[model samples]
Target chain A: MKPIGLKDLFVIFLKAGLAFGGGLGILAVLEEEFVTKRQALTREEFLTDYALGRIVPSGTMSALAADFGARFGGFPGSVIALTAMVLPAFTLSVSLSAAYVYLAGTPVLALLPLTILPAALAFIVAAALRLGRDITIPSVEALLAAAAFIGSLVFRISPALLLVGGGIVSMVILAFTERAENPA
Target chain B: MNPLQVALTIMVLNILTFGNGPALVPLLEERFVTMEGILTVDQLLYAFAIARVMPGPANAYVASVGFFLNGLLGAALAMVAIQLPAYLMLPLLRLHERFSDVAGVKRFTRGLTATSVGLIFASTVSIGRNAITSLTAAIVFVLALVMAYLLKWNPLLSLALAALAGLALHAAAPSL
Candidate 1:
């Protein structure tokens, strides 16, 4: 494998950031450009790439960019796509961070938090609901979720315990189900 | 502390943990609570509230907290540090299809997802405990929950309504 240099990394990051900050709509445009017009990959390939990206750690868009880049131009392509995805957001975040400090302690600053907190809570609740809808929880799974919720809320159980317990239960259930289905 | 070191630490934290961003909160609190001294627990709660209200990613609030500490430089450092690792790691993953498809890796991810949900749940309880002081606040919480779960109302809109209700209640009973 060719060694990636500092200059190459920087260029890739810069390009990915720019593309990412351009927003999801722009991503759709890029998909059409590269996947459709360029015939780099088919729609099924693109969808699989994106699904894998979402299922894996990190942001879905960044993952997709990396997958596409790797496919198109090997390591260099992956670097370019990742850079394009992140650069825009990175630049904006840096600029905003600088401006935000200057504006601190103002009434606007106070108001900003006031508006943001409720929205954030709402987002959290919505996310939980969305996740719940997606997963096919058996009665045991539902019981586990309820137990975790109650343990966290009522008994002050550590979140770590709930997570570990859930994992163990799921693994055991999966193992038993697999064994039962394929009994010799 | 060197600005670059600070940035790197945040970047590393973001990468090591899953991408939920807020996952770094407890760890960040443990690290910076003493060194920075600018963010009191109360202020941290307030900042968290503000981040929640905002339309964008919850981790974006790190900028607000960083700004509170060492001004623009701090905020810039914090944002870069938090996001940089993810930016760097995503591309790296593309090259190793086998690495991505490993069974152990999938199990680890599934475990992480479960942990993240639990953490979020814990955070909700903590946040709710802090914010829901009065009868009106409790009402707002229940309403928000119903709207989110049952009515399927958009979260941002529900939040806006809750904020409006809070503001209106505060105005009506200034003494309370």
Candidate 2:
């Protein structure tokens, strides 16, 4: 495929950002635009970017947009793509924040928490299941997962520390396992 | 609570978690609600509600959190802080050959991701304790799970149904 212009990159990501339902929703939009509609990237290329986005420590959609931008237009393109994708939600969040602050005491808006919070919890449960689907039961990964749950919920440890520490320990164990198996 | 603190908190959270916007909920609640006392549980729920209804990443709600704490400047800083870490991914992606070649990298990601899943569940329990205050809400929670998970309804549709149920239930009893 030919190189995509920065303007086109911005427009594509801007459209993707307008998708609701968060990250999964945005990914569908991006696949449609980049792979099927514009043919800017092949299906396999889009999937690779999606996988790369998963491992990076950022929102998957935002990271994917940056990667696509860097591919098409370099660093500047990357910045522009990410900005365009994030702008819509940021604007809405600020606007909603203003509304919530100003109208919080009213009875009508008070219903939001009663209605929304429960659903949000349900959403979180589903998200957790999706994230944990690959882990086998009674395994080392399960043990680490259980430890994280207890550390965050019971012991009240800093989640940032838990993630970093867990990742380093997991890497070392994996390295040792690999060395032991190969005997190199 | 100050501009610098808000920026740093958001930037740190973004750099640690890998996934969609909702992935930030555990760390975000830990910082703002449990640790700092910046916002109450209900306030954060309002932000999450608005985020789910709005377009873009759910993490965009960090702007709402910032706005609640310090107004427009906080919101702007939050957005910038959240987006900045995506650039960090650019460098890692640029080194994709070496990055993917390392077996340890994949294992490390697996471990981090599993832990994140656990944290998310922990936050769900924490948030649920505060949010599920009534029978109506409990019912809606079950209905939403069924719709969004089993039936595979769009979250927007499920949330809309939830809002309607809340209004009807609140009106019928006015006591819940």
Candidate 3:
């Protein structure tokens, strides 16, 4: 690809942002537009960055931009990628937030929680399942998920503790798995 | 009611957690819903649902909370606080390749990934308990899930269907 400007970068992520709601299956679009068409990043690089993004706070989209943006255009590139990533969605969120605040106390809007809440949970479940299918491959991770669930829901363990302890356990497991595989 | 506090809360939460915001919804409930009574569980979940339907990072929901507490300025401040840190950290992320093989980094990263999965599942349970009550609601949830998982419909489309189902159900059985 020729030298890509921040304007083009912004447009690319703006299109991705538009897909976020119902168009959440945006990887294909991204693959076609950025990877194949624009030659922005190779497929392998995008996939690796996406996986790395999962372990970060912002999740896949922003992570992709942050990771590759630095490589592609240095610090300025990363800034543009991150800003473009949020612009469209942030605008939508602002409007939705305003409407939510305005309609908060009305009788009719009260029904929104009763109705939309379930849908929200359902969406979370769906998104989780999609991601979980990837995480559960190691069976041990599934156990961790189960353990975490019990600890949080039944035992009421502190979220911070569970996360920290779980991370420690996983680290131990990774070390053992590595040693077993390589015998080093 | 304090915009600064809300901004600070978002920044702290984002800084502390290693994954999506949904995974840590319980902490949010403790702080905003129960302790402060800033918003009821229903309102909070509803706002979260709105955030879901919108396109963006999960942290954008902080703006929704800010909007509830103050207004547009609150939303802007909250968003800036949560996101500024991530941007600042980008440089570290870029430089981390030098330490990629360090045992401590490997352990921290892998461990956090597993823990994040568990935390996310836990949040699902917590949110589900609050969201599901009536049979109608349960049905809507399952339908939405099927729509998302099976049909692979757009989230906006599935959510639109769900909103319609909610309205219809409400019209049919007001008590439910």
Chain A TM-score vs. truth, each candidate: 0.66, 0.81, 0.79
- The alpha-carbon deviation from the true structure for residue A116 of candidate 1, after best TM-score superposition, in angstroms, is 4.0
Query: What is model 3's native contact fraction?
Result: 0.58
- Provide DockQ values for all models, in the order shown: 0.25, 0.68, 0.52
Scored by DockQ, the top model is 2
Q: Is candidate 1 or candidate 3 better by DockQ?
A: 3
Q: TM-score for all predictions?
A: 0.65, 0.90, 0.83
Q: Per-residue CA lDDT of candidate 3, range B134-163, in tens?
A: 877887888888887789887778888987
| C-alpha RMSD in Å of predicted model 1 compared with the true structure | 6.1
A1-184 in candidate 3: lDDT tens per residue?
7877767766766676566543233455567777888897888767765655555554455566666556667788777877776776667777876776678579867777556778888876776676566675556677777787788778888767777787788778878887898994
Judged by lDDT against the true structure, how good is candidate 3? 0.69
The regions of model 2 sitting more than 4 angstroms off are: A1-3, A42-45, A176-184, B98-100
- Scored by lDDT, the top model is 2
> Which residue pairs does candidate 3 place in steric collision?
A22-B154, A22-B155, A22-B156, A167-B111
- Comparing candidate 1 with candidate 3, which one achieves the higher lDDT? 3
The best candidate by TM-score is 2
Error of 3 at A44 (Å): 5.4
- Model 1: residues >4 Å from true position, as ranges? A1-33, A36-39, A69-115, A135-184, B1-9, B21-104, B134-159
Error of 3 at A116 (Å): 1.3
